[model samples]
Target: MRFDISGHYLLLQAFDRTGRKVFGGEWHGDEAFARDTEDPSGVSGERRNIQDLIKTLAASAEPHNAILASDADEEEHQAASDALHQINRELGQLKERLATLPHVTGSWLADHEAFKRRTDIESKLFEAFRSGDLDLQVGPNEIVQWRTWSRQPDFKVLFSMSCVIVPRSHAGQRRRGPAFIQLAAFEKWLCRFAGAATGTEELTPEAQLEIWLREKIKGPKEFSKPVYRAHALEEIPELSARAFDRVWDNVVPKNWKRRGRHGS
Candidate 1:
């Protein structure tokens, strides 16, 4: 099990007594984390460091007794839930306080200076960090997984923020190899989409490699959107044969596979 935080920013995985994955999730802040990633947030450096501890704990495969593993699983689940709840509550309080301020009306005209301030305030509120990064400070002894958060616009309003984690792992694998494989599959299908034929002919060094789309792409007859890409990849058999060596090289420890397996 692994936690995919802030999209691909971080991943946390845990295993149970029988080497079974127990818990996996993702965490990301609202505006702060997103803006920080695109830009930078010096303030969150200390908080991000907690990720190192989580990585260490997950890699250590100390055999877990049945009861101990169960207890640990329960503890982690409760901890994650409680932390999310606390964040929501804090954001709610902040919203109430901000709402007390008088609402200022501004000009609709873009050239007006008041209009500029009004637009700026609106943008900031939309991109404001609601209940995400701030609530998830690094705990001294535990990994806190953040589930959701909100952003403040104007005063008392609360907006629901959401994103998706694409499932990329195949059965029995706990890494992102599937994502890369999917991309490769898309590349292959894209070639056909652009009327490009696959061949064994030697290519020139100057040939550019990029997924191209034709001006008149008569996509799969059934649908109009990009869902056909998935269908096309599914029809191909070679995807399964594609090795996940790249993923393993980045994630697995050098020592774990080189030496004999360590067991209890």
Candidate 2:
């Protein structure tokens, strides 16, 4: 009888004195039975004998030693062992070469740390902006400096100002309103600014009216002064009603239609 272990089961084959297969089966869990015999019912005796052999093998001190394999199995096992040994030797050589290389340290490490710090600060800055703790306004000079430094010829500084600073002809066009700077664009600009700004510099309010005006312009073509005042109060709590009106009168287009008026 020879036993071959294949995955989770054990295959058993018994040969007669003439080297002809007398019984063959597979053992699973606690059961053993003849599977390929000519007359399975008649081979009940053979099955019992095989089961007894399996039990004896299981009870052996080293159950693995009880398994039987042909010469081909031994050769395959030797080949696999040699491959594993070769892999280990190659890994050892790689480790030796890596150890001989210089240790990595210096400017690159400092640059990485600086990048991480900038990321963390930028995240906090954006969070503050979203939560209304920080305003979008910055000085005109600062905006100009950033615009020049960015080297983006198409960068619109009007979107960042407190008023629609474009020519009256451009302002009349619907596309060039403060609404042109969507929240996403504004946040992107903020992120870029955060990256370039020194950690010690403080941001100032420069575009509160422009921000409010943009939102209102996006909604209705006609709105009342009281409605505008109410929105200003809600959106720009830091600015007084008088200050809001002053900025509104100065920046609002003269030809803008009111709720009751047909023309400017």
In order of appearance, the predictions have TM-scores of 0.15, 0.29
The best candidate in terms of TM-score: 2
lDDT of 1 by residue, 1-264 (tens): 132221121111100100111111111112111221211223234334444444443343233233344656787656655655564565555455445533332321212332333333324323322322112112111222223312212112111211212123211232111111111122232232222233212221111111111111323134322332343235332322122222223223444224333211
lDDT, each prediction: 0.27, 0.37
Q: Which runs in model 2 stand beyond 4 Å of their true positions? A: 1-102, 113-185, 188-206, 249-251, 257-264
lDDT of 2 by residue, 144-227 (tens): 223232244333322112222333332333322221212322432344332223210221121465445654555544656767
Candidate 2 pairs with clashing backbones: 137-206, 137-207
* Per-candidate clashes, comma-separated: 3, 2
